[model samples]
Every structure is written in structure tokens, then in C-alpha cells.
Target: NVYADSIEWMSRHLNHRENVILSLHPHNDRGTAVAAAELGYMAGADRIEGCLFGNGERTGNVDLVALGVNLFTQGIDPQIDFSDIDQVKRTAEYCNQLPVPERSPWAGDLVFTAFSGSHQDAIKKGFEAMDARAAAEGVSVDELEWAVPYLPIDPKDLGRSYEAVIRVNSQSGKGGVAYLLKTDHAIDLPRRLQIEFSGVVQSTTDAEGGEVTSDQIWAIFTDEYLPSQVADERWGRFELLGTRTSSDMTGDVELHARLRDGDDVEDTTGHGNGPIAAFLEIVRGRGFDISLYDYVEHTLSAGGDAQAAAYVELQIDGERLWGVGIDGDISTASLKAIVSGVNRAIRTRQLESRLAAV
Candidate 1:
């Protein structure tokens, strides 16, 4: 109130002739320099002076970056260019030898990153919809209105890519992992797969006690699902040879499967209400105790020729596991998911046995 009153008094009495320009230079003695500067501007001050990153004695001076960006976000031009804020932060840190907090507004490492599941999901979907709309309208991304979740300003406007916007940690969720994979590797995972992968990421990060990088996540994905048919001798327990499904007018479905299990090849026939059920019955008849709990499928890419992705969750002996598969055919993808799930379950049991021995 005193600062505003002083500014008002000066503007009214000292600058009555309109021959003088009032300026404000506020300190951080009370840690309100930025507020003082903003108020001074509104109170008719023509100019305000502050140091970068609030680097001064005591609490230092007001943070010009914060003040300026505050104005920029309000659709007001602060007449300052902060398009490359990371560079600005680097320069400041180098010259001052003072580290900036990771949560610093607009200039920190994790400022643009989201860890919560809901936030990550909203942000991911928001960016996707924005891009689709921009492409449909034949306009640049900048021309589109900015309304991303949990982000006040577009990071790209500051020369930052979306790669770092969603990082995975123990507290992260399915959407964050999916966003990272999609942005970094162009692999768009289905929703169920995202959930499945999030569990893997959480476990890895929990064990490592830190953030999981994109490369590590990709390695896990490949190791879990992309085993070679011929090179993976351990996976010879079940190799899909061929499958045929027939549906009659009464809605009855019959499935015939030829499977090679460890040098013992055999043909099996089963009847169920659906293809997956029939396949499960065949496996059950072979002495495997597996039950399907959940299933989800989606197209990985756009257009008619896009690839499909499927995710399956199975309960095997009271333990649950998830699997993912991708292919040009939806049915094939689902079957692949089943195979992946069984393989993962087997691996889990082996790991448990080893740990118990240890």
C-alpha cells in the first residue's frame, strides 16, 4: 500500500507537468520485489528495473524473467525475448555459479514435466488433438490456440520439444509412458498396453530409485515382447503354426489350431462363444491353467492400412500379468498378446524360483 501510494503521489504531484518519467527500482528486502514492480507499473510507473533470476544480495532483486513471462502469458508483450529460456537459464547459472531449482517457474528442468497419471493423460491427448486440428486446418502449431493441460505456455514456444514434457518415475502413470514412447520413438501404444507398460516402468524405477529414460523403457518393451521366433530356443514351448475359425448361422464358433510345443507338434480343436475363448479352452485342455481377465485392442496408427495393437491381462495361478502385441491383423495381434502373456508368466515364475533359491 505504501509503495502504491508513493507512486500515485509522485505521478500526481511530481509529474503534474508530464515532463518527468517515473521509474521504480525495488529490492528484495521483504521478498516482494516482483510484486512491487508489477504494482509500480500499474500505479503509473514508466519503467521498472530488476536483476535476472533475482540474483542480488539477501533475497536479491526481483526476477525479471518471472515478471516478464507473467505479462506474456496474459497476452501482453513485455518487449523481452525469452524464446530460448533454457539457454538463458544456462547462461545465468554459468555466470553466477548458482543452481536454479528444478521447480523454478518457466526456467527449471522439471517445470514442464508432469508426473501424475491424470495430468499426463490430459496433456498427451491435448497435444495429439491440437496437432490433428492444426493439420486438418492447414495451419502451423503456433497458430492454434494454446490450451494444454497443466502447462500455462507451450514449451515449443520456448524452443523446447515435447520429449521432456512427460517423464516416467515411480509416481508416473500409463499416459506418461505412452507419451514418452510416442514422442521419442513414434510407437503409439494402445491404452491397455500403456497400463501394462506403466507397471513395468514403475517396477524398474522403484528398483533403480530414479527416473527411467526412454532408451531403458524401449529396451524393456523389446525384451518383453519382441523375441525372435527362431533364435529364442527357450520360447519353443509354444509356436503358432496355423489357425482357422469358422462361424455358423446359429452364432456357434469352432476354432482349429496347429501348435508346435517343444518338438511335439499337434492339432487341437475347441468350441467357444468367441475366438479368444476357444483359444483359451484349447490351452486349458493342454493342462495350462490360464484365465483371461481383461482384453483391449486399438489401431496404432491412422488410416485404413494402419497397424493394430492388442493388450491382454491373464490370471495364472492367482498371479496376474499383462502382454502386448502389434500386427497388421487385429485377431493376430490378440493371439500374439496371449502368447506374450504366457511367456511373461513363465519368466516370472522362473525368476521367483531363482529368488527363492537365493
Candidate 2:
């Protein structure tokens, strides 16, 4: 509704042009505040009003930063400058001013980054193309890189430094090497090196089965600088059980795991159907039927020592539960995931039982 339409509207008497910078303040009280704000934008409002990070009254208001970026991506330049969004974000955190979770879209740690090999490959290709475009156009690479895929807008446009573009951790991919190298050493490893190094990293991390650090990568790279095919470093062991190898090499392997859990006696061998499956089977066999519903796995570290973590949703017929597990071994991680799911199931069932008794 136009501000002029209000019963006591007086601003309408003043000159307000059609090309106006309209702002929206959405309250979470009704949850439609953001939607209403977007509606205003759609109705040709030039500017949207919002708090720096959506810090406002109960449930907060619209996140202006997110909205601004979204507008920028849509080719509508947000005239309001927030070139140093990162600094602003940090300040917001340092002041204990807000509770912005890392999972928040556009501003989260994991938003632009990917872990799966396929996703990494795609992002790498996208940046490569963007780089090529800038080279061909003779424009600043900063200008060209803005249109790269996955990224809504050029991070630089919002004053974000390249340092935060990609973070290499256990869950990272070969692209991570390029990301880190570009940021840390101002050197971009050629494609061949990235490919060769990924396998090295995977093997080194998987075998050692521990956290791999930047220093370790540099040491390994210096020690064994091979054009291709370096011998396996044999960092850790993956114990296989149950499934027999079909001559073709494409079959599911049932995984049962013996994991190091704290001190000696607490060490246990959980089971699951798949990796987690066999792990669950082992646990159920031990008289603990951890009812599980959902499980999600993601790589944690970048190159070597990438830890796989599993979050399992569980609910017993009459109880409630929650469980989580992590390990270098994907299968072992799956086992932990199942345990988590089972625990959640127990919790749910228990909740139901209590409700029924009441």
C-alpha cells in the first residue's frame, strides 16, 4: 500500500518521485515480513530498508545485507555500499549482537564451497571460464569473476577478500589446492598438478586417517613432486567385510567397523546395513535397537585426513534419541551415523510413551 493512502498520511503532500528508493522492514512476528518486503521490491521499489544483519525487535527484521546481495545478483545495483561485508559480519559477531548461523545462505561458510568431487569439478570449471573471459575482454579479472557460477555476485563487489573465497579443509577437494595456493602463495597450480595432488591428498589423508594440515601438504608436495602417479603413502587402513568382489568392480560392500572410542573398554564394534547398515546390525545384535530414520554424511577436512561425519535421526516406537559420529573412514562414519539415528528414534518413542501415560 502506498504511504500516501494511510488515514493520517502527510508525506504524500511532499514531493516523492516515482523512481524512489523504497525500503522494507519485515518483522519475524508474522514471518511474512520478508515476503512483504520482497513484494515491495517487485512493485518497483528501488531501495529496501533492513537492519545491517536483520538485528531488530522480536524475531528480527529483514536481513538487509542478504537482500542487498540478492538485488545485486539480479543486476539491480544496491547503491547502498557494503563493500566490506565481511568486516561488518565480524563486527556484528564481535559485538555479540546477533545469532547468524553459518548455514545462512549467501553468508554461510559452506554456501559457495562444495565437497563432492563432481561439485568441485563444476566450480573449478566455472572459475576457469570466468578467468578466461576476463583475459579475453581485457577487463579487470575482478569484474569478470563476478559473473562466475554458484556465486551470486562478485564477492569483491561486496568488499569480500579472495582469502575467504575458498577454504581448504578435510572436506575440500582438489579445487581446494588451487584455492589455497592462489590465496596463500599467489600461485595457481596448473590443472595437471591439481589432479595429481588430489589423489595424493586423498591417499595421504585416508591412510593417515587423521587431520591433514597446510604444513603437511607443503611438506608432502616438496618431498614428492611428481608429474604423475606417486606411490601410495599408506596413511591408514580400511578394513573390508561381507561383500565379495564381483569381477566387474561395481558392487556394494557391507561394512562393519571397530572404532577407537576413548579408552580401552569403551571401544566397540557397531554395525550397519550398508556401511551404516552393517554398523547398525552390529549394534542391534548387541541388544540395542537404535531406531534410525535419516542420516547425512559430509566430508569435513579438505585434502588429507578428511573426516566424514554422520548425523543420524532416531526415534524409538516410544522413545526419543539423538546421535552423531565422525571418523576418517566413511564406512566407520556411517556406523556412527546409524547409532545417532537409533538414539533419536529411542527419544521419540520415549516421548510418545510419556505422553500416553499422562
Best-performing candidate as measured by TM-score: 1
Off by over 4 Å in 1: 15-17, 56-58, 88-102, 116-118, 125-142, 185-196, 225-230, 233-237, 241-274, 303-305, 317-320, 350-358
- Checking candidate 1 for backbone clashes, the offending pairs are none
TM-score of 1: 0.81
Q: Which candidate should be chosen as best, given lDDT against the real structure?
A: 1
lDDT on C-alpha atoms for all candidate structures: 0.82, 0.56
Each candidate's TM vs. the true structure? 0.81, 0.48
Candidate 2: residue 290 lDDT (0-100): 53
Task: Give the runs in model 2 whose Cα sits over 4 Å from its true position.
Answer: 1-24, 29-36, 44-49, 94-96, 105-116, 143-145, 178-193, 204-215, 226-358
True lDDT of residue 266, candidate 1: 88
Each model's backbone clash number: 0, 51
* lDDT score at residue 221, model 1, on the 0-100 scale: 80
Tell me the tens digit of each residue's lDDT in model 1 across 226-305.
Answer: 54646645552566667889999878779898877668888988788888888888878877799998888878678899
